[model samples]
Target: MDYQPDGQTPYQNTHSQNMALASLILGTLALLTCGCIYFAVVCASLGIIFALLSKGGSLTMNTSGKIGLVLSSLGLAFTLLLYIGLFLYVLKTYGGFDGFMQESLNFYGVDSIEELYQMMGVPY
Candidate 1:
């Protein structure tokens, strides 16, 4: 039984594939820039968005999109965990956030907050 349909064919566009490709690229970038909190977060967020969009229409997603989602999630998780650990360590070691900041400035050889401000050429 051969059932041939009518003559109207749907428009074939590569937009979904492009989204998958973009997701992959952003996910890769998120991993690459893991040391930078801002870049890592931004790239991972964008990658996840693109991946979801690529997976929006159907039950299955392209391999690249799946990989992108995984990598992006891993990057975001690693970055968040790292920062949280560092924050907790700093909080434990120092009396408070302000103390930690002051200690950091002192470690950098700035005698006081005013000196740091002066070094940065901020009129205070």
Candidate 2:
């Protein structure tokens, strides 16, 4: 029952607007959690999906949707780069995945993977 100043019914695009808002929120979360690579990836992916969905049948997206898409994309890229860099660093410093595992187990005073799991209270 909303009307414009000219006494005409206001055009309502509620669904699209809601989708755009969700995209924005998720995009922000993705950016904030970029350091947590896995979480950032999940949030960024969902944000991108919502941003695209907000476009509906239109060829163009609203401002919020566009911003969300950009933010989410950047977040995802940053997360990937961060993880890749960490992996390379670990490989160089530890000699390999096995060396890294050995170091971790030694640091935790665990003789084997099963012992580590038991120490962490995880059922082996």
Candidate 3:
């Protein structure tokens, strides 16, 4: 008897709706900041969390939440790949970790990591 002829549910899950919107916004931010690995990871992680929470114990998510989840996942993947590529490039350019360390020390005008740390009063 409470049903309306329009056939749509009278009550809306406002909390879920808000969460889905937040997820979408955060996912967009994650994608936009993909070049900054740390910032992108944080945004992507929060986006994924918001999307999952938007499900609200339901087995299925609304469309916005699903899109947010996908975008955040892609952002995380891209961040990981960027870091891996950077590491590989560093290894190839420097010949190894030792070479990289040596170059770093030279750049700092120090003979060794311990010397650099001592110069900076880091208790080596």
Question: What TM-score against the true fold does each predicted structure earn?
Answer: 0.79, 0.78, 0.71
lDDT of 2 by residue, 1-124 (tens): 4556787778544338888888898899998999997889999999999999999876789999999999899889888998899999999999989999999999999999999999999998
Cα RMSD for candidate 1? Answer: 4.4
User: Once superposed on the true structure, which residue ranges of model 3 sit more than 4 Å away at CA?
Assistant: 1-15, 104-124
Candidate with maximal TM-score: 1
- Candidate closer to the true structure by TM-score (higher is better), 1 or 2: 1
User: Higher-lDDT candidate among 2 and 3?
Assistant: 2
In model 2, which range of ten residues has the least summed lDDT? 7-16
Deviation (Å) of 109 in candidate 3: 6.8
> What CA RMSD would candidate 2 show?
4.0
lDDT of each: 0.86, 0.89, 0.87
Instruction: Give the per-residue Cα lDDT of candidate 1 at 95.
Output: 75
The residue-by-residue lDDT of candidate 3 on 1-98, one tens digit each, is 23356877564443487788888988998888888988999999999999999998667899999999988988888888888998999899999889
- Lowest summed lDDT across 10 adjacent residues in model 1 is found at 1-10
TM-score between model 2 and native: 0.78
TM-score of 1: 0.79
Candidate 2: misplaced stretches above 4 Å?
1-15, 117-124
